[model samples]
Target chain A: DVKVTQSSRYLVKRTGEKVFLECVQDMDHENMFWYRQDPGLGLRLIYFSYDVKMKEKGDIPEGYSVSREKKERFSLILESASTNQTSMYLCASTTAGANTGELFFGEGSRLTVL
Target chain B: GESVGLHLPTLSVQEGDNSIINCAYSNSASDYFIWYKQESGKGPQFIIDIRSNMDKRQGQRVTVLLNKTVKHLSLQIAATQPGDSAVYFCAETGSGNTGKLIFGQGTTLQVKP
Candidate 1:
């Protein structure tokens, strides 16, 4: 089983503060993703990495950035957190694309920006 | 923009009954569809998936049906339990090797005992 671990379960930060959400996978998967889950707007991809030091912006990547310094570690960074950024953040990984494969997800991190 | 969407926002069914959740997608190029279940305070978990070449696929206690003509997807759960009560989202992927998924607006399922 692939284990994806997020650094925080709940996070609180003030507006304009820099925030970091970390995710690490034990399995040497080639793909990692960061998504934000909102009430009416399902899970929108924020960023995804196909390999170490490689990242791509997803649909909603305005207020967020990502890092994949290592194969097992992927990170989401909020350069300046805003109240609108308060939402549940999720981390996911897969050995490859959805060639009938599933994406293993971590327990989400709820961010509350004040 | 091409995206995935659900027909209903919520569905309530009696315990032990069957539940069907429907999803609509606008992207015809989407070759992969997946159903995910997210319980309270948790991330979405993979339930089942169907490829573009297949019409239906079955997993443990769950079945996914895909209609490529209409770009519609449905998830059927057998003997729905309280644990089956969760938000279900259907995802579609088009022309991507990064496993990038566009998720639908979720359908919340409630199983009453």
Candidate 2:
């Protein structure tokens, strides 16, 4: 089975602190994505990478950035955490050119900024 | 801007009864749609998917129906069980090769025994 592993299941950080959320997928998929989920806003894409060292901003990428330094590793960065940034972050991946809309996702990391 | 939205925020059904969750999309160019189930504290799992070429598709106990005329989609679950209680989200493929998906706010399904 394909597994997407998130480094942190839960994290609490103070305001203005820099935070890193790491994700590693064992399937060697060509595409990786970062999304944030909130109560009424659903899952909004923060950023996505189709290749190593390449990234694209999504609809809600204002407060986030991403890095794909390796084929299997994708990281989400919060330069300065704030209370409004508190939410569940999800990592997902899929095979290249597979536009079938099926995404394998990690368990998700719940981040709380105080 | 393209967006996907749900008609209801929550749906309640009795066990053994059928449950239907509805979604609407504004992107007419979207050819692929998917339904996902997310339990408490877990990531969204793919339940079923339907392509624009087809209006209806079925899986083990779930059926997805697409209405291109109204740009609407629906997921029907047969014999809804307690284990099926979760938040259901419908997504449409965004226009691009990156395979980005626009998701709905989601509908919480509550099953009563």
Q: Estimate each model's TM-score.
A: 0.96, 0.98
lDDT of 2 by residue, A48-95 (tens): 999999999988898788999999999999999999999999999998
How close to the true structure is residue A78 of candidate 1, measured as C-alpha lDDT? 97
Q: What C-alpha lDDT does candidate 2 achieve relative to the native structure?
A: 0.94
**Cα deviation of B37 in candidate 1 (Å)?**
0.8
Q: In terms of DockQ, which candidate is strongest?
A: 2
lDDT of 2 by residue, B9-102 (tens): 9999999999999999999988899999999989999999998999999999999999999999999999999999999999999666458999
* TM-scores (chain A) of the candidates: 0.95, 0.97
Clashing pairs in 2: none
Candidate 2 residue-wise lDDT at A11:
99
**Error of model 2, residue A72, in angstroms:** 0.6
DockQ scores for all predicted structures: 0.67, 0.78
Give candidate 1 misplaced runs (Cα > 4 Å): A97-100, B96-98
